[model samples]
Target: MSLPDALAASILSDRQLRPEFEAICDCGGRLAGTPSERRALGLVARLGEAATGQPAMRIPTPYEGWSAQEAALHLLGDDEEVELACYPLLRSVPTPPRGIEAEVVAVGRGTEAEFAALAPELAGRIALVRHEYMFAAGHLHRRLKYEWAKRAGAVGFLIAGPLPTRAVAGSSGRGHEDGIPALGISPEAAARLARTATGHARARIRIATEERPETTETILFDVPGGGPEIVVLSAHIDGHDPAESAIDNASGVAVMLAVARALAPHAGQFRRSLRVAIFSAEEWALTGSRIYLDTLPADERGRMALNVNLDSVAGSPNLTALCSGFPRVAELVEAATREAGIPVGTFLPLMANSDHANFAAHGIPALRLVAGFDDPASHCRHVLTAADTRDKVAETELRAAAIAAAAVTWRALTSTDSLR
Candidate 1:
């Protein structure tokens, strides 16, 4: 069967989808388990129902929640009051020292090797590590390094943010629940603290974080048909603080809504089932995907032909698709791009960090489609900050992405040939 160009065009031309993007921005920040996150989930379900005429159900998963109670830092003997901004680490130690002061020591980059080199001097001191390079890299390597510093006998951790070329924000992860107080400081504040410390300066950090084990829902909307295979389309419905998450994933959700609208009328036409999954807690270590994978029946797992994941697709000049495990799927994506007149590019190896990771881990073929980094000014900035508002998204880009995704899904569902 050939691809349906008209369906793709219809999906792309739909302007009603803009309200969904606005709703995302209006939510402010949809951190996992927060009210904003719950509202975003409801919005997604409403969109799905409106497009597909089906009720979507929420699937709950296990998670430990933590909120920073009191976060502060005291410079050993500085009489000058230093105003420092700090965020608590995820899953921080249950009990933290309130006013205990220990000597401060600089451990360079705070890498494993660096900590090993400073083991002798760091035994009883608070480890003040420069997080400048780490922040620029978007908290990628900071966690492991912090773990190493903890093992080296550092009483507490003080991460110095990188010099502000652009505004930077900090967030804690599950690792922070290990019972040690972890704090992030602005670069200027860190510099002042570094200058004031003499030979031995006492550094005191206090963190009161609450950890609660709660079960949260993960919603999956499936449209099953009598096809030999299945094409699964996915998008995560969660975001980080300060970011309204309009571009990061709300854009992806809008694309999913458009796809559902384009495919609903022709659901029975294809020889395979089309599944749309709006995942939860994607930003929190792909929690929803992990749980979904574990619960899938083995027999149903093999029926999955391809998993197409849409993430961050609403604002860019060029669109890129990351084909992680399925080379044959890449060929189909190329065909779709050609039909749509959109360019395609290959990405690095699969990180299995998104919702697609769960399906890929079960040996299911998958592809992650996204907008490239060379987008306009509005879309590029405010990645995880407050700048990821609705105004940053371009309606043209969103329409294009939806059309491209529909093209890819149609081809994948109908094509008999396999890329594996």
Candidate 2:
């Protein structure tokens, strides 16, 4: 089925898109459990209600809450000691009061083979790895690198951000487990830690964090249709504290709001209801969505027809759908995008990098719409750094993404074939 031109036009002409996007960005990085995150959630709840003309249903979820107090790194040489800038990865274990002083081992890209080759030397040493462009096929996640370091008996882990002078930020993926200290450093720091003529370079890492029981909520706006089946459009509302997190997720949330606003008036024509889910703690290994799916009854979850997760959707003009191993779902997305005159490519591999993966894990057809996959030069490369602000996203790019999302969602809602 083709997308209704009126809905498409509404999505394109959404005056609220830019305002909502900027509002979310102004909330600062919506780090889970922070005041900023709470503010963003409150704003999103209002926006969602405005779009769907219904009050939001909030589902409370419990999770391990964590916040960093201080993180410092010092490169120690024979006669010189240099302090470099660094940020603690989320859930990174706090170092001892005096901190951990150890030799640094460079593992380059921190691939499996690279970690294997440096296995013997990693024990009691700090593994240094580089953060690659995250929106790529072969990118090795910082979490994997940290796990490799831990498995190798490393005392600490460091990931150098791709951008110079900017420290990276993300989850350590340790998730309430015992793990070594991990930090994201700038490129300059990585170079300073390179091996000297004498032997391996040594550095001191000190990190302080507080962990406690925390609760966050997922906001749901249901635009009811004629049937019980549902189609979900989700976007993460949380991100690291480094910057605005505009491109990584604020863009997604903005576009989701626009699509919902355009579709709510036409819900009577849809065969399935549309649920706009604003999730939190997504940066912590997709925690919010995982909890949402886990807590939902099996029968209710089975009623889900498809999940179109928008994440980092507009840093670049190029958009690709991470199809989560669903070939049929990919075909449907392609047809929908084509019919809408929007260019969206599909990659069939299942990437557990976003909230959509959790939906796919529950046997639902799911896909993540993202921008600038495999394009290093795109503004998407600035994600996870301090540069992920509203300036990085263009108004045109955000609107196009909204139109594409609306098209795909409309197609799924009106399709006669079984989504399953």
Candidate 3:
């Protein structure tokens, strides 16, 4: 058998894939700067060393940290007040003890034109927007909606979750800077706050949070090849506090681990070194990878040939490489998948939604492998909701992702042409 086929077979047969994924899920939602994140990082350190035969290096990363103590939302009416379920978006600035009461305006889907049309009505009011399926094409990010609300002079922001009963969760994209209060609510809560005949509906939002300086670490494993050029294989270890963050990223980390195990032994035969970067705090605006890359010298960054980032790789049977505006990288991925007898799709846009964007901004060709792209029915919709658990990922799906990842990494490691 050919060497790539032999490596793919080894990865498919490796018994640690599912176990490692479940173990990460078992560690609870690995919220950055939390105990849960620490536990998962420790587990990954051991497993990564075992897989790559290299001790994991913990690169210290410091950043502003935030934790929500309490967040409450209530609808105000003439005679009765109704309380609604809500979760605070990460890094949301806390309101006063009594909270801010303001008129609530619903902007449909939070499109730019919608916000523009409602510009006059948004000022001094709380803007409400809908959260769409994230893995689909043309979908808007919550951070963009939040930023629109803030720029429109809105007092606060509310994102109605896509799920029926569960409240969504994600970063507010605001660091330690001044920002409006933000929260995620269920669809039912959004329905109740519709425009009434009398005037815009009024709601009260109270959020209490604490902020401090914190430090975390990004793990790295370097498996040197025969050449100076490097191929970076990366995945984020951090996720939301809701559920297990399974379909969003545990699948990616697991697939990465399995591929590393199967391919590290053959690095000496390849043309590029394989650098495994497992990052934390990715949920907080991709901070982990950004910090790691920013700290490197320009000469060191120039040595990087490509970055193949695995994220949300197995929520569905389908996989697509978000090639970060590099069409040649997409072609390479397609060829690798074809060689392995697996079908993988490609998208030719630069998505700042994952760690790969950090590498792309540095002029390195970077791509993010994701599952269920444009497939709303896929379990990836459950990400950031309470329903995102280990059960949402299937063993076969994870193995398929690992096989494809191994093939791609192997091809990238041995290819003589410039990846960029």
Candidate 3 all-Cα RMSD: 1.2
What is the Cα root-mean-square deviation between model 1 and the actual structure? 3.7
User: Over all chains combined, what TM-score does candidate 1 have?
Assistant: 0.84
Off by over 4 Å in 1: 1-3, 73-77, 94-142, 157-179, 184-187, 190-203, 373-381
Pick out the ten consecutive residues of candidate 2 with the lowest summed lDDT. Answer: 411-420
- Pairs with steric clashes in candidate 3: none
lDDT of 3 by residue, 97-170 (tens): 99999999999899988999999999999999999988877889999999999989999999999889899999
TM-score of 2: 0.99
Q: How close is every model to the real structure, measured as TM-score?
A: 0.84, 0.99, 0.98
Give the deviation of candidate 2 from the true structure as CA RMSD.
Answer: 0.8
Name the best candidate (by lDDT): 2
Cα deviation of 224, candidate 2, in Å: 1.1
Q: Rank the candidates by TM-score, best first.
A: 2, 3, 1
Q: Show where candidate 3 strays beyond 4 Å.
A: 1-3
Which regions in candidate 2 have their CA more than 4 angstroms from the true location?
Answer: none
Predicted structure 2: clash tally: 0
The model with the greatest TM-score is 2
lDDT per residue (tens digit) for residues 1-420 in model 1: 444877866876787778777876677577777888878877778888888777787777876665656767767565653446655544545334555567777776677778888899877677777653321123335566567767888777777655342223444344434535677666565665563424765666777766677556676677766675878889887776656888778888888888888887887777788888888767666777877878888878888888889988866756767777577777788877777676566554564546777777888888788775433343544555456677778888888888788888887777756755
- Candidates in order: C-alpha RMSD to true structure: 3.7, 0.8, 1.2
